[model samples]
Target: MLQRPQANEFDSYFTKYVYNVGDKNINQFLRDQEQNIVHLYNTLSEKEAEHRYAPGKWSAKETLGHINDSERIMSYWLLSVARGDQTDLPGYDQETYVNHGDFNKSEVAALIADFQRARQSTLSLLDSISPAAWVRTGVVVHKRVTARTILYIIAGHTEHHMNIIKHYGNRLT
Candidate 1:
């Protein structure tokens, strides 16, 4: 089982995501969360998916798109660090990515499919890491992070958005 990353393993900004994971088994938690999110999102109507909780906030579809994009980026970081890459990875603006994504224009089903595919890719990458590689460090957005911390971030990031999506669902009902 993969151990939880220490606070020093990641940037303080990501503490919420990491703590959101708590003591759950990382591998199983990722798998189960994917299934739960996919199943929940599958039930949304097009109109419901397009509803934004606030005027400036992301709609449900855009939120899922953001989740997919973040997982892919973090997975890449995980791979790079696990492979002993010493390069410093840059940060991305989620708002800019979401604006360009045009997720609101796509079918909600399509966004959900994208989420599943991205998650599967992340899982596959995680499966291939050697035990020693989990502790490998890399610079991301100027902060030093371990390969395992990236994994937790991916999971925590999803969890954070899942909570928002759930709130959206509540308001829709």
Candidate 2:
């Protein structure tokens, strides 16, 4: 069984995300989340996809795009770190990425398709690593992190966005 990574295994901020993930079987959790989130996105109309809960909040589509972007970045970090890369990974600006993503202009189908591909890529990388590789540590945005913690973070990050889509952004209806 894959254990929940220890607090010391990742940056403190990321731990909140890891805690949000329910399943300790990180690999399966990642696979499950991809389908679950796409299911939720499929329920939204284009207008609902564009809906923003409050002023300055991201639209539902943008939020999904952000989730996709985050997964890609985190998974890249995990792969690099697990492969024993000691280089300090750069921190990304979420706002900058989202602002430029143009997800609002794209069809929901496109967004979901892109996200699915990114997720599949991540899963492929994860599957290539051995159990020992899950414990490999490296620097990302100045924080010491392990592959195990990144998996939990990915699962939890998806949960976070799902919650917002389900509640905050027009109830995902």
The candidate that wins on TM-score is: 1
**Candidate 2 lDDT, 1-173, residue by residue in tens:** 78988888988989779898765577777788888888988988998899888789899899989988998998888888899999999989999999999989989989999999999998888779899998999998898989888878888988888887788755433
Residue pairs whose backbone atoms clash in candidate 1: none
For model 2, what is the alpha-carbon lDDT of residue 166?
81
- TM-score per prediction, in order, is 0.97, 0.94
Residue 159 accuracy (lDDT) in model 1:
97
Which 10 consecutive positions of candidate 2 have the poorest summed lDDT? 164-173
* Candidate 2 wrongly placed segments (more than 4 Å): 169-173
- Each prediction's RMSD over C-alphas, in Å, is 1.0, 1.5
**Model 2 steric clash pairs:** none
Whole-model lDDT for model 1 versus the true structure?
0.91
**Model 2 / residue 38 / CA error / Å:** 1.3
For candidate 1, write residues 96-120 as lDDT tens digits: 9999999989998888888899999
